[model samples]
Each structure stands twice: as structure tokens, then as C-alpha cells.
Target: MTQQETHAQEAERRGSFSSRRVFILAAIGSAVGLGNIWRFPYVAYDNGGGAFMIPYLIALLTAGIPFLFLDYALGHRFRGSAPLSFARLRRGTEGLGWWQVGICFMIAIYYAAVIAWALRYTLFSVTEAWGDDAAGFFTGEFLQVSDPGVTAEIVPGVLVPLLIVWAAVVVVMVAGVQKGIGAVSVVFIPLLVITFGALVVRSLFLPGAADGLDALFTPDWGALAEPGVWGAAFGQIFFSLSIGFGIMITYSSYVHRDTDMTGSGLVVGFANSGFELLAGIGVFAALGFMAQAEGVAVDEVAQSGVGLAFIGFPAIISEAPWGAFIGVCFFASLVIAGLTSLVSVIEVVISAVRDKFELGRAQAAALVSIPAAVLSVLLFSSTSGLHVLDILDHFINQFGILLVAVVSMVVLAWVLKVLPLLQNHLNRNGSFRLGALWRILVSVVAPLALTYVLLDGLWNDVRTRYEDYPGWMLGVFGWGAAGLVIVFGFVAARLPWRKDTPMDVTDDEEVQA
Candidate 1:
């Protein structure tokens, strides 16, 4: 049988999302994570405050959602994970899919550790256990963080929770799509919104909340002229929406054939942005209150990434009314958001492995999770683990994810000349018709934007040691980690695709075979 014929049969064996709503919720859950809550607010504030929204929204419509639609069409049309789907597109491109999946593998391991930290802090919020020195506690006392280059013993505080996180994720994967991933996302996404909504409402009433809102939305119009601002906006949209990780492709593969592809992409995009905007409001309001209490500038208290979540927010919680309660809700929301996204991240690898090997879901889950869990525990559970996580996360996201995205767009828009084909599929299966504009966005706008970001990032890295870490450390954890992703991608792609018990195609209308 031809490759298409085999893929057609495999579609029947691969499980599906139970409904359109479930699929959308899962997609939203994947998109709305720590980036929305911890990263977006800071990024918006720095890039021109309220003024940044213009560029951000522009990127979302032109680049973010367009790429989203492309992934949806590819996955729905091909009915496989990134490897199988890309292989279907063209024989040699299968390695790119594995490369994308490799990036996902890197993300999933470190991401679980971050989620584990949130879990620990949720319990710590009970008494503001970090006391007055939030930073000291996080690094010196709690983590016992070693010197950057030194490897320290595991910290139980991080390790115990990380194990739970891995187990929970494994359970969800093993539960199968509808009962496991779909069901959890349905519950978690709503709960995440409600919890954060209540936090936002309470925050809006706090003294100095307006100051935080001002910092978030008060636009410095002149900043718009800077190239960096535009770059930031585009970067934020790309990273925030969970594109480029084989996630949307993997998720959309399970979507029902009759589902509205265009509508689904729009819904996921808008939902992600909506949550991000809401998160900005809540985060800034709390920071404003913190700034007021400290008699400092909002920028002094504002931060992003692990610093913002663990240090700055803990300080804010320590002073607020019912501080303990608010702290619990805040960290709990982070855990929920992180877990949902983690599920999608791991699923990318799981789906790829299952498709490539023709293994059962449970078997694929075990193969992926066991190594990922071990790496999470061994590397991140150590006192130096946070340092390693920071370095790897930076390099992987900058060099790995962004580069893969640029290449994927190039192959689709230029190499294959398939934008028209993908556009037709979207219009036929979706309520909304994608026209010349969509094609232009994918072919012209997105690639240029992504390419600029990639170049800027490379320049920045070459100029300085990230965070002032030693050059050797950066080489080991930063560039070295990224290089390994490409190496593994080709290695995994070279493995034999399963031939036994080819998947039976229940519906071949959308599939090429």
C-alpha cells in the first residue's frame, strides 16, 4: 500500500476528541498557561504598556491565528502527529516534524518542574512561609540553590511535588483522550478562569489598583516606532499561543471531521488573548498594591518568569488582606494553567511516538513519560536544577522553537506552495472562508516576523552571557541543549515507521489516501 493508504488506515486507530467543545477547550487550555499569567503582563508593560496592544493584536490576527489555522489544516488534512503529518506533506520533511517534537520533549520536562514549584508554593502560601525575604527563601533556604556551575543535592521541596506532577500527567495521558485529556481540560480550563476572575475582581477593588492598570495600559505612543517593540509583540503572540510545538497539529488531528476549522482557530486564538488580557489586569492590580505598600515604582516590583511568580507575587501576597487565601488561589491557578499546557506538550511527543511506532496510547505514554519524568526529577529536583532549567528553557525556546517555526512556514508557503491548498481545505470544512489575506499572512507576514525574532535573539546571545552566567555554562546548557534538539530530531526521524496492523481508516474523505 502507498504511504497515504497506510496513514488513512491509522486514522481509525488513533482516538479522537469527543466533541468540538472539548477540542476547543483543550486547545485553549494548552494556549493559556504561565506565559499568559506570568509572562504576558510583564511583556506588555515593558513594550509600551497599553500601547503594546496595537502591535500584539496585529500579530495575533496576521501571524498567530494564521499559523494556528495552518496547523489545523495540516493536522486535519493529514490525520497524524507532526512526524507523520509532515511526512505525508513530503517524504524528506519528516525530520522537521521530529525536530518540532524534540523541542516539545525539552519543554515538557522542564515545564513539569516549574509546575511542581507552583504546587509547592501553593501550600507555602498558607502562612506566607517565605516570610519577609521572599527571594532569599526561594534561593537560599528553600531551594538551597548552589553556585551556577556547581551541582547540588536534590531539594525535597521541589522533588516531592515534581513526582506528583509527573504521575498526574501520566495518569491523564493513560486515561485516553476523552476521559483523560479532554475531561481534565474541560474541568481545568473553566476552573482556571473562575479562580483568576475572582482574583481580578478582588484586585480591582484594592487601593492603587488603578496605578497597576495604568502601568499595563497607559501607552507610550512613541515606543511604537521602535523595532524592538514590534518584535516583542510578535514574539509574545507566537510564544503565548502555543504554536510551533506540534501542539495545535496534534490536537487538531483528534478533532471531528465536521468541526469548523476556521471557527475553531478563531475561538482558540481569541480565548487565549482574552485570558491573557484578564491576567494582565489581575497581575498589575496586585503589583500596584504592592508598589503602593512599598512606596516604590511599579517597575521596581514588576518582574517576569520565575522571579515574578515566586518572589514578587509572594511579597505581594504577604501584605494583602486575607493574604494567605489570595496566595492559595493565585498559585492554584498557576498549577491548573501549567498542568493543562503540560498535557498538550507531552501529548505532542506521545502522539508522534504512537503514530510512528503504531503503539497503543498507554505504551506511548509510558515510553515518553518515564524518561521525561526521570529528567525532570534528576535535573530540576537538584539545588542547581533551577539554574539548569533557566538556561535550557531560554535556549530551547529561542533557538529551538522559534527556528523550527520559521522553517515550517518556509516549507509550507514556499517549498510546497501549498498555501492555496490549505486555504481551500479550511474554507471547505470551516464556516469562515480563508482568502488571499490569509494566504498573504502565512506566506509573507509570519515568516518575516519569525525570521526577525530569530535573528534578534541570535544577536543578543552572541553579544552577552544570558543573565551573566559563565560562557561555559551558557555553552553547556544554552547552545548545547539547542544543538542536541536537532541531533535527536534527525535520529528519531530515521527510525522505522511501524508496518504491523496498519490503522484502519474510518473516514478517508479528508485524508489524502
Candidate 2:
């Protein structure tokens, strides 16, 4: 068959985004998530306050967007899911793609539970359900968290909402790309912005809002000299942007071949950062109000992750005027953001499975999401779920995602020597031209910065147990889970591709592009 015929066949087989606009919205939806809302504010505060923006922007420019462009180039040029793209890139590297799929698998399992929690919290905001003790309510009542050991006992509160989240995700995935993922993005992204923007506005009028802003934005110039601050900047950018994973690669593969990927990357990258800044403003303003109401310092109430969202925010909601509105907006934003990101994460697995096995979209969605939902509900609805989730998140992100990212970059740039080829593809149609600097950033600087962050995290984890959890708990959920992903990757790669799946870029295909 001619290369044009092959492209047409593949386009029919694998759905494309309806247009570049939908692709941008979908990409932005994936990039902006729970981290922007809860994590970035604290990372900024802890790193160097406002002064951290220097390194943050530097990391975004030099590392984050560059890596994002690399993912875009790979997916757009190859026009396949991660595994299929890597297989076409070079057969030996297919395992790297599966490695990413494995990471997403583990991530999706735990990530859904968090979204479930947020979903419940969104409803709870109406009545101020936590009453006076948000922390106790979250742990003792809601999660009913037990000791740090595995158990089959389930928490009804978490299980029901978790099922809801999984159900919604399956429907979206089965609906295929444009109608499901794209439609949700077009709707939810705007809703999220409106609700969260109102929440930020509400927060600014609260008493002591200025104090929170001051605490967050006050520059610690001396922090610029600290290597740890730079590391923190790069680490936050990496985690926040959703790069170095199969997500962007998979999403980009759905865009038309001639789409301006570089331009889209810039929009997504900047939009995510803009939202993070808005999050900082909103989160800290509420936190500052909490501190004033409790007659304490802003630092006393400041927290991140679950604590910030479920615990600290509840306390703020209980005190602030129009507090229920604030609570609903905040938690709803979490649900919206988390749901969008979770859909993208699950899609990586679905896309890879469909490509490798040549399954229909509905079949792939059901196969990938059902088992994931069952495992997610089973693991996270139990008393020990929190502990396991905590350990898995920490270890998997540090070892699984970051480690594989470094390895993928090395293989693609050094071993396979495909940087030039990808660059050519990007420059041919990209609005922003990529040249040698882009290559150096992807191959050298980004990896080196990531390596430092990875090694630093490794040394810390090795020196002492994460969160001082029992050794066995860390051993199983932490180290053992991370190791299993690598093993799963190589094993999955060994499985034969579907007979009809194209595994190579023919010479004719090269000329056609």
C-alpha cells in the first residue's frame, strides 16, 4: 500500500482529535490537575516564596516545555500510542513505553481514590460535614483509617464515590477521544476556571488575605543560592506538567499530523503555570483567613496535598463568611481537575492496550478500566488504604516515573540518536522552531537536573523510611511496587503485537510525512 493509504487507514483505526483547539484544551486539562491546586502553593512557599519564580520559570523554559515538546514530537511524528510509537521508533525501546504504561497503571489505581475523596468532600462542603474536626473526620470517620497494614475491611464512604469516579471514567474512555475526552475538557476546563476564579476572588476579600499573600510571595533572595530550591523548582515543574510520562505522548498522537505541537505545548505549559499561580493566590488567601480566625500564624495552618484540601480547607470553610460556597468551589475544583487528569492517565493504558492487541475502543476501555477500578476500590476503600496509597505514590513517582524518564531520554537521544529526526519533524510544522538548544535541554540539562532530584530523593528515602512507616510497609508498597513496574514493562514488551499493527516506519511513510 502507498504511504498515504497507510496514513488514512491508521487515522480511521485510531481516532484523531476533531481539531487543534480540542487537542489544546485536552492537553491543558491533563496538565492542570490536583498538584496545581494543592501542591504548587506550598512548594513555592517552602522553596523561596516569590523568589522561587526565577528558578521555576527557568525550569519551565529549559526543562519542562522542552521535555513537553519532545513528547509531542515523538507522538506526532510516529502517530501512535506510547508503546506502538516506541516500537516504531526502535523495537528495543518498546519496553520503555510499557514501563510508562505500568507507571500509569499504578498511578491510576491510587489516583482515583483521591478523586473519590474530593468528590465526597465537594458534597460535604454544603453542610460543613466535617463540623469542627476536619482532620479527625477525614481520618477517623471518613476514611476510618486503621494501622499501617493491609486489610479487606472497606470504608463505605470512600467506596461509593470511588465507584462513581471509575464509572464516569469508563464511560468517557469508551466514548472515544473527541466525544468523550475532548467534550469533557471543553466543558470542565471552563467550569473549573470559573468556579476556581470565583473562589480566588472570594478568598481575597476574607480577613487576613493579605498576610497569606505576603507569606507566599515575599521573596527570599538568599534562597536563590540554595541548590535545594532549584531542585525543588525542577521537581515541581516535572510533577506538575505531566511530562516524562505516556500522557502527553498518547494525547499528542490523537492530534492531526500537521498540528502545531510546539505552539500547543506553549499554551498548555503557560496555562498550567497560570492556574498554579491562581491556586497559590486562592489557597493561601483562604489559609490566611483560617490563621486569623484561629488567632495563629499563616504558617501554622499551611499544609499541602490531602491536608490542604480535606483538612485545612475545611477549617477555613467553617470560619470564613460564605464558607460553604468557598468549600464547594474548592472541592469541586479538585474533583474537576482530578477527574480530567485521571481520564488522561487511564487513557494511556487504554491506548496502549488497544494498539498492541488491536481491540475496539469499547473493549479496550472496559478491559483496562474495570480491573483498575476493582483494584482501586479494593485497595483504597480499606483502613490501610491511606498508608498504601501514601507509600505507593512516593516511591512510584520517585523511582518509577522519574527513573524511566531519565532512561527514555538517554535511549532516545544517545542510543537511538533520534533527537535530530524528531526535531526535524517538529520544525517542519511547529509554530515554534526547535534546534540544537532544544536537543541539549532534552538530552543533557533536563536529565541532569532530573537526575539530581532523583538521586536526592533516593538518598533521603534510603537514609530513613518514608514517613517513618513500618519497614515492611515501605518494603512492599514502596520499593516492591516500584520494582514490579519495571518487571511488568519488560514482560509486556515481549508479548507479540497484533498481526495487523504496523511496527515500523517504512521508507515510503518517511517520504509521505
Candidate 3:
């Protein structure tokens, strides 16, 4: 092939989002996921209600948006996915990219199953099938509740829905970036916003809704003194913005060369936080009504994570007027939220493999997803699946995700010394210029905070076997899972790159660009 023709082909291989708006939507889609809807509200309430916002906003500025912009600069300037982007930055740094992608892969395995639960519940919402005993129905009738640590048979009830979730994810991924991830984000992001917006509005009209809002916004100023509350705020901002995973870096890799990285980062970050605020309104409003019906305080019925969604919310829906319709909207919104994020998680792994092996989009999706699907079923298809999911999720986030972020920050800012160049790229292309303050926030403040959290987590794990689970269980699943990803990362980094891959594309191309 002619040299110019070869250059065009290479550009085609590195896909671009159809437009800036589509890229923004896809980025926002990845950011606004299950965490914003299912986890944030409860975390806020538990961490001193309105007072949490103080540290949350501080973390957003110092850590969240700064890290987000740094990731964007790496992808857009380099024009490569995580593995290629990091490798382009420095030769030996490729392992960190693989590590982040591996973490995303592990997360995608269980995330699909969680979305499957939301999908099943959406249908059940029509019939109010959960009935009065929502907890019993969830644990016994729905999941069949096998004992923890038991090697139970697969529950068809869970497997069938999970299959549907993975199928949806595969279809979108097969369609490729702009036509698939971008198009779906355009549809799903707006739909999610509308559905949740309507739910929030409707919730405001419910009895005792005022009490829920009060609990959400009413500050316990004294609780702000607790160091744990500050840590909680930072943790919420860190996880909710989706910065630690390879998702942002991969999504940004598809953007046009001139795309505004700083503006985009601010928009995605604020949109994520805003969605969580809206969710808090809806969740607590529903919980307030539940508390009133049960003749107790909102705290009595209020919960977080799976318990809040499957148990508390379902019971609230069963008692509300037009219960079935409300339930359908709530769970449908949940499904959309989860699916949007799930695709991004799957894409991180697929993109990494595709870049390294030079595979076609469909081939890459199938290669990565087949194994992910099997792993999903193995871990989450049984009655004891929730226990398994909880352990993997805890260990992965605590050690896997957080550790990757800590190392990435130090590597980028200190070792590679690329922050200044990235800042220049963001300022030159973006409407708002990043100054010295942005550099300080990323190079110093963010790393220090992340290091503190990592140390604190290590200390806690040493002192107590997380949740008082047996040491063997933590050893096999918790630390073992973390170790597996680290091993895979190094192995993948050592794999041979595609032969046709340009030295410029794979090496120090971004530095020249």
C-alpha cells in the first residue's frame, strides 16, 4: 500500500466518535451509572447529610475533575486506548494500563448480573410480584438463597435474565464506537434522565416526601468533625465520577483531535454529581413514604446498595398507590443506568485486547465477552451469588481500583512527567485554560489523598477480616482476586504487539503529536 493510503487506514482503525456532542454523551453515559442511582444517596445521608457536600465538592475540584482531565488528555493527545496510550507515554508503563483494564474486566463480570436483576425486577414491577415480603422474596423465592460458600447449582431465574443483559451489551459493542456506544448513549442517557426526572417529580408529591428531603439536606454539622465523614466524601467523589477505571481513558481515545478536554471533563463531572442529587431526591422520597407507612423514622427503612434497591425500595413500591407503574419506572431507569455503564466496562477490556492484537471490532468483542459471560454466570448465577458478588466487589474496589489510581497518578505526574504537556494540550484545545493550580491539584493533592486512603484500607484489612468473614474466604476471593489481576496485567503487557502496528502509533508518537 502507498504510505498515504496506509496512514488513512491506520486512522480508520483508531475509531472516532461521530461528533463532539456524541462523545460528550458517551462520556456522560459512562459516568452516570448504577453508583449514582443506587449508591450515592445513601452514602451522603450516612456521611452527615448536607454537611458531606463540603468535602465532596473539595474532592471534586482537587481530585475528581483534575484526574478526569488528565485521563482525557492522555487519550486525546495520544489517540490510543488505555494500553497503547500508556505505552506511548513510557515503555514500561503498559502494565498499569493492563491493570486498570483488568480491573474493569473483573467489574464487568458482576455488573452485568446486577443489571440483569434490574431487568427482571422491571417486569416484576408490572405484577408487584415481590408483594409484602420483599426481603424474603428477594432472598428465597427470587434467588433461592443457598448458603454462603456453598457450591450451589445455577439458578435459572438469575441466569436467564443475565443472559439477556450480556446479549444487549454484545450487540452494542459489535456495532462499533460511534454507531454503537455513541448512538446508544444518545438514546439511553436522555431516557435515563427523563425517567428519573419524572420519578423525582412524582416522588416530591408523595406523603412524607418532605421528611425524606429533610433528611437528605438537613446537615448534622457536628458529624463533619469526624475524619471518617471526610473520607466518605472523598470516596464517594472518587468512585462516582468513574475516574479510577480505564473507562474515561478509553472513551476519550475516540474523540476528535480538537475536542475540548477541560470543558468536557467539567461537564461530565458535574452531570454525574447532578444525577446523584436527583437520585437522592427520588430514593429518600420513596423511603420516607415507607417509613411513614411502617410507622417509623426514615432511617428505619433507609438502606444502601443491594438492600436498598431489592428490599427497601420494593417494599415501598408494594405499598404505594399505582405501585406497579412506579415500580416499573424505577427499575427500568435502573436497567438503563446499569446497561450504559456495563458497556463501557466491557469496552475497556475489548479495546485493550483489540489494540494489542489488531483485531476487528466484532472479533475483539466476541473474544473478550465470551469469557466474561461465562465468568458472570459462574459467579452470579446461583442462589448464593450475592455473597460472591459482595466479596469480589469489595476486594476489587478496595485494592484493585484504588491501587491502580494511586500508582497511575504517581507514574503520570512524577515518573513520566507528562502533566505539563497534558495541561498544555487541554489549554490549547479547550476553551478554559488549565493553570498552575490544576497542576498542583493533580500532582500533589490527589496523590496524597489517594495514598492516605490506600494506607487506611490496608490497616483496616489487617485489623479485621472485612465484615468478619472467615480469613480463608478473604484469602481465596479477596486478596486472590487482586493478585490474579496483577498477574494478568504483567503477562498481557509482555504480549507481542501486532506486526503491522506503526512504530509511531505504538511508541512515542503522542509526544511528537
Candidate 4:
């Protein structure tokens, strides 16, 4: 069969999205997850209070949108393996494909840990397992990273449920994306949206919600005066967009060739970020009401704890009617959010493997999922073990992802130089070019910005050796980043560079034979 014929047959053989709506639903489900409700609110409040959104918007427009298109162009144009697309998009200016794959593999492992953590908390919340002084229960329990000096009392009620939570993640992941990821997302995404929206409306009616809104939106643009502010904005936007991780390439691979790239990226970006804004508003408003009631400041309570979902949110809900019900729904929403992203990470590797090796997606998925599950179980043994996952995340993100992105852009723009043609195909019967501004941004400006991010993140991480986090933790984390970079460079140096025929078609279309 011809390459196009093969893709058409595969599209028919595989369970294609029932419709465009389903495809869109799946996309939104993949993008809008725990990053929105759980992480964003906490990061927003802690970083700049209300002032953070200034650089955030700038980064969102410049850094986030342009890269969103970049990832989309590669994925839909080439469609199959993220690594293949990465290599193909650049046509081997360098072999940077391995770097992209490595980033996905590393994140696949650590992200499993995070999903397990969410699962642990979801069960705890459902059972009302936290005892009196829920805040103290969490603050005094397993969160050593939050309160290093305090002793973590082992509460069986909490610990046992956390284990069960880990099991749920394993089950969902092992089942594969088509059966597990797609099925769960179709149900959970809508339910999560309804539950979160309901809670946000309820939170607004609380005594001090107006104050909360002020705290999130009334940005002090003077935050722009600080270099760190811009850096934080850039970092968060990149992190939130999930562009560099190869997951975007994986998901978009399944997209239709003639799909509207500009519209699709915009919808996913806005929906994902918009919900985060809602989450921030609700969280801050609830905290504002809590502060008014307790006469304590909002900043005093915004610690990064898995326990916060179980403790803090319940406390906020406790004031309203159906407080327990609301708390349950909110935590459940987080559980849903966690699954979406978690499943996407798994799908990335499975999709890559299946396309490359002519393996079944189910078999490839098991190969990835089983190892990740075993790794998470073995890794999170010590109470301080969770911090290890953070180190791996940082090293992989900075070394693996940044390197691959730089190589890909250079290859496409300077080496193979067919990005313009592929992009033109994307724009046929369409509007909007990637334009010169984005060209400069990705080629010259973006790489420099990413380099600064790597150096700054690594330096700040290493500097922590002087702090109270124990010398060994700093040592492992510091050298880990450097080691990853060196290994990545070594491997990338060896890949062949040549002018190959551009296989620029969507997975639903055709990128290659």
C-alpha cells in the first residue's frame, strides 16, 4: 500500500474519534488537568500574590502561543512518533530525537509518582480520613518537604488510603489510552468541569470572595521591574503549556490533517489556562473568606501540600451548605484532572513505540506502563523520596527538552528549511502565517531565553546546598542535571544529518510510510 493508503487503512483499523467533537473533547481532556486546578492556584498565590499575571500574559502570548503552533505543526504534519516527527521536522540537522524521547521517558516515570500522589489524596478526601484539625493533620503528617523540622506522625488512616490511591493509577495506566485514557477522559472531563464550576460559584458567595478576586487580578505591574518575575512567567508558561515535553506531539499525531491548527491550539490553550484562572480565583476567594473568618493572612496557608486538597479545601467547604459534598466533588475533580495528564504522558511513549516498531499500541503501552508503575513504587519509599521525583523532573525538563527544542528549531529553520512549506500546507484554505516575529522568536530569541532558563534553574537548584535541605539531596539533584545534559549531548552528536524527503502529513493523514 502507498503511505497515504497505509494511514487511511490504519485510521479505519484504529478506533478513530467518533467525530470532531469527540476529538476536541479528547484534546481538552488531555490539556486541562491537575496543572490547572491543583498546581496553578498555589503557584500563583505564592510567587507574586496578585502581581504575577503581568509577565504570565506576556509569556502566554509570546512564548506559549508560538510554541503551541510549532508543536502542532510538527505533530499534525508528521503525525506518528514524537521522536520521528522531531527528527523529520528537522531532517537531521542533529539527531536530537533521542533527547525528545528521553524527556518523555523521564517525565513518564516521575509523573507517575504525581498521579499516585493525587490518587492517594482523592481516596483520603472521599473517606473523610483526616481527623480533627485537618490542617494540623496534614501539616503534622507526611509533608516533610513543607515542614522539615516537624515530626511526621504515621496515621494508618492516611497511609493505607494513599496505597490504594497508587493502585488506581496503575490500573488506569496499564489499561492503555484508547481503552483507559479515552474512556476515563470522556466521563471525567465534563464531570470535573461541572464540579469545579459549581464550587467556584459557591465560593464567590462566601463572605470575602471580592477580596480574593482583587488578590488574583489586581496585578502590580511593578512586578515587571524584577528580572525574576519575567523568568517565573516564562517558566510557568512553558510548564503549563506542556509544549516541550513531547506529549503535545503525541496527542496531535492523532489529529486530522485538515484540522484547523490555529483554532485548535487557541482553544486548547485558552480553555486550559482559563480554567486555571477560575481555579486561582476560587482558591484565593475561599482563602480570603477563611482569612476573614480566622483573622489570618492568605499567604500563611498556601503551602504546596498534597494534604492541602484534603485539609484546606474541606475547611473552606465546611462553611457552605453541602460542604462535605462540595469537598468530595472538588477532590474528585482533581483526581480526574490528574488522570488526563498522567494518561497523556503514558500515551506519548506508547504512540512513539508502536509507530516505530510496528507493535500493537496495547503491547507498547504495557511495556511503558509496567516499568513506570514499578519505578514509582520503588522510588517513593523514603518520606523524603518525593523530592527525588522533583529533581528528575527538573533535570529531564532542562537538559532533555530544551536541547531537543533548540535542535529541532535550528534544523527546521536553518538546516532542512522546509518548515515554511509544511506550515504553508497547514495554512492552505486557511489564514495566518507563522510570520517573521515568531521566526526570530524561535530561531534566535527563544533559544537564548531557554538557555537562560536552564542556567538559572540549575544554579538556583545547586545553590540550595547551603540551605537546610541536607547536603546529599543537593548533590544528587545538582549533578543529575549536568549528567543528563552531557549524556544527551553525547547521543545527539552521533545521529546522522541528511536531506530526507519531508513526510509532512497528519497521523490521520500521512507523514511517512
Among these predicted structures, which one has the highest lDDT?
Answer: 2
* lDDT per residue (tens digit) for residues 1-513 in model 1: 875666545656788899999999999999999999999999999999989999999999999999999999888877788888788777678888999898999999999999999999999999789999999999988888998884748898888999999999999999888889999999999999888898898888778889999988999999999999999999999999999879999999998777899999999999999999999999999999999999998989989989999999899888898788778889999999999999999999999988887588899999999999998898999988888899999999999999999988988888888888778777877887899999899989998998999899999989877999888889988999899889888888788887663333324333332
What is the full ranking by TM-score, best candidate first?
A: 2, 3, 1, 4
- Show the colliding residue pairs in model 1: 9-503, 9-504, 9-505, 10-503, 50-217
Model 4 per-residue lDDT at 477: 53
| lDDT scores of the candidates, listed in order | 0.89, 0.92, 0.85, 0.63
- TM-scores for all candidates: the values are 0.96, 0.98, 0.97, 0.83
**Model 2 per-residue lDDT tens digits across residues 376-447:** 999999998999999999999999989999999998888988888888888877899999999999999999
Estimate the overall C-alpha local distance difference test score of candidate 4.
0.63
lDDT of 2: 0.92
* Candidate 4 TM-score versus the reference: 0.83
lDDT of 4 at 469: 53
Candidate 3: lDDT over CA atoms?
0.85
Using lDDT as the measure, name the better of candidate 2 and candidate 3: 2
Best by TM-score: 2
How many clashing residue pairs are found in candidate 2? Answer: 0
Clashes of 3: 0
Give residue 219's error in model 2 in angstroms. 0.2
Q: List the residue pairs that clash in candidate 4.
A: 77-505
